[model samples]
Target: MTKQPESSVARPHPGALALGVLGELLITAGLVLALFVGYSLWWTDLVADARAERAGDRLRRAWAAPAAAPPGQAAPAPTYRPGADGIGFLHVPAMGRDYSVLIRLGTGSEVLDGGVAGVYREPYRAAMPWDASGNFALAAHRDGHGAKFHDLDEVGRGAAVVVETRDHWYVYRVDGTLPRASKFDTGIIAPVPEGSGYPGPGRYITLTTCTPVYSSRFRMAVWGSLVRVDPVDARRTPPPELRTS
Candidate 1:
């Protein structure tokens, strides 16, 4: 019998070929997802921290240089105005002796994603620490972008939460905490901050963040009452609360 061409090499079954392609695609997708997570959780933080540090330094420099009133006019009282850079710093000794983050005007990503706490401007305008009476509500990411409020859970009742501005330090004593609340619960950031256990209106501070770490399915809040306001002396000394052992 004439030698027939060696039987054509057996081809892979279509099903097998499809499965091989599927496996490669899955592996690629997994690698891409991991890279994204790393970027979101790590790289973003580095960038945000650098930005925050630069902004904070600029703010301190501005504070150090005061404009003198011309022609012997009386110096006007310093007003709290938030410029594009930021407003001030937030210090929670309960978090750490050196734990502080810059604070800006709005809770939008543009502010918080830059590794800073953001004041609420929707539903209700957040009261500045300088405001006579209202909630100085603030929010920050708990798991990424510097995670400024990552240790918020450590702040218990009686803990101090201090807001440092150019002229003063507004100290607040933690009053209560809501570990879990609906993300849509605007009441948690209201002027009086509902569910905060406060009997009525007062100079309060509400710190809000996403719950359950690495997820944003819910929200958490820490409420505090104004304990005191310390004037920033020429030396810019920190308050006793910040002096941790």
Candidate 2:
């Protein structure tokens, strides 16, 4: 065989193999993480955009009066007609009525039932919008999957949140943010400021949500005051957003 020329056989290098595997794993993990992060970002953005579109739709539907109501049928009011069960619409330009919401006074977050909503009665109502002398407080969940109030955090101190009824929209502007509040914190519960001697005046709106990103050991409350409550001129409806990128 003429000394077979050292049998030029190639053997796998252990170091290269290990490095290859690690590189593959790292690449896979990187891809997965990239996908997750992208999904999360897009999810939130989509939610915000969809809600904005729905808000505009609500305004349009509110504006459109049934040209003569099929001749015999009477036209219904702009507000979603109260169902036979009696639950009507809760309109907020930021969020549509599709999310069931109720404004209960004495009831607390526990009553919110993981659903999308806002409160108009009691503790929250006493001080919010109605209680010119105190902070009108409200709370809703920032749904991760559905995006109910996900954009709420984006609402700047100057941004306006409108709460509309069958008749009109009640607008409030962000005035302050409560990073965290202790258990049974009266200030967080009441419309007045904490540690203040007397009942604080200044009509305000307080919004409560969970804190520390995912955990709920404490409450994050954002407070604002009613600047105005204007009639929703459905006729002056803004343009529709049919699609989003």
Candidate 3:
């Protein structure tokens, strides 16, 4: 018999080849999705946390530096400038004893990338802690970019939310929470937030983050009212509320 041609051997069906290609593509897509999840859950946090630390240090240094006096005047007092490089620090003992993060002025990617909360600048800027009657509103990431408020829901009613400034520690008591609210519900941070039980204008603090753990479809808000303002002491000791809880 003449030598048989190898080309005559049976080959895979076209359908089989197509299926193989499709399988490879699916695998590649799955891998890409996993990598994205990893980046969102881990890598972004590491980078953001580092940046936050640097920002916090800068704020501390600024506070430590004394202001220069005029040629023939008393030395200017050290101050906490709202729109300055660092506005203040937020402390939530209910989240954790060390759960303190810096608060920046603008709620933009640039400000939030530092892994800290940012105050709204349009329609309603955050009222200063010293403001007699206004809302000190803030927003932070719940799932990425440091996730400073990741456990915001853990804060129970009557928990303490403290804001530390250059001159004072503004203590607020958690009154209630809106488990899920539309992101467009600007009233959550209003001077007198509806449904917050404040009834009228008062010193208030509103902490907002994305809801449902990792989704931004809705918002989670924690509302509190300023109970008192304590002058910062030399030791910077935590207030009784924070110290106890």
The numbered model that scores best in lDDT is 1
lDDT tens per residue, model 1, 160-243 = 899999889999999999999999999999988898888888999999999999999999999999989999999999999987
> How far is 132's C-alpha from truth in model 1 (Å)?
1.7
Q: What local lDDT does model 3 show for residue 232?
A: 80
| Best model per TM-score | 1
lDDT of 3 by residue, 82-141 (tens): 334777899998888778999888777777766988887767766777877899999889
What are the Cα lDDT values of the candidates? 0.90, 0.51, 0.86
Per-residue lDDT value at 165 in model 1: 90
Q: Please state the error at residue 13 of candidate 3 in Å.
A: 1.2
> Model 2: how far is 196 from its true place, Å?
9.2
The whole-model C-alpha lDDT of candidate 3 against the native structure comes to 0.86
Q: Candidate 2, 133: how far from true, in Å?
A: 9.3
Estimate the TM-score for candidate 3. Answer: 0.90
Q: How many backbone clashes does every candidate have? A: 0, 10, 0
On residues 57-131, what C-alpha lDDT tens digit does candidate 2 reach at each position?
554464454444657787653322211111222333333323334343333443333233445354344443433
TM-score of each: 0.92, 0.50, 0.90
Order of candidate numbers by TM-score, starting with the best: 1, 3, 2
lDDT of 1: 0.90
> lDDT value for candidate 2?
0.51
Model 2: CA > 4 A from native: 51-161, 179-203, 208-220, 232-245
Model 1 ranges with Cα > 4 A deviation: 1-8, 67-74, 77-83
Q: What is the alpha-carbon RMSD of candidate 3 to the true structure? A: 2.5
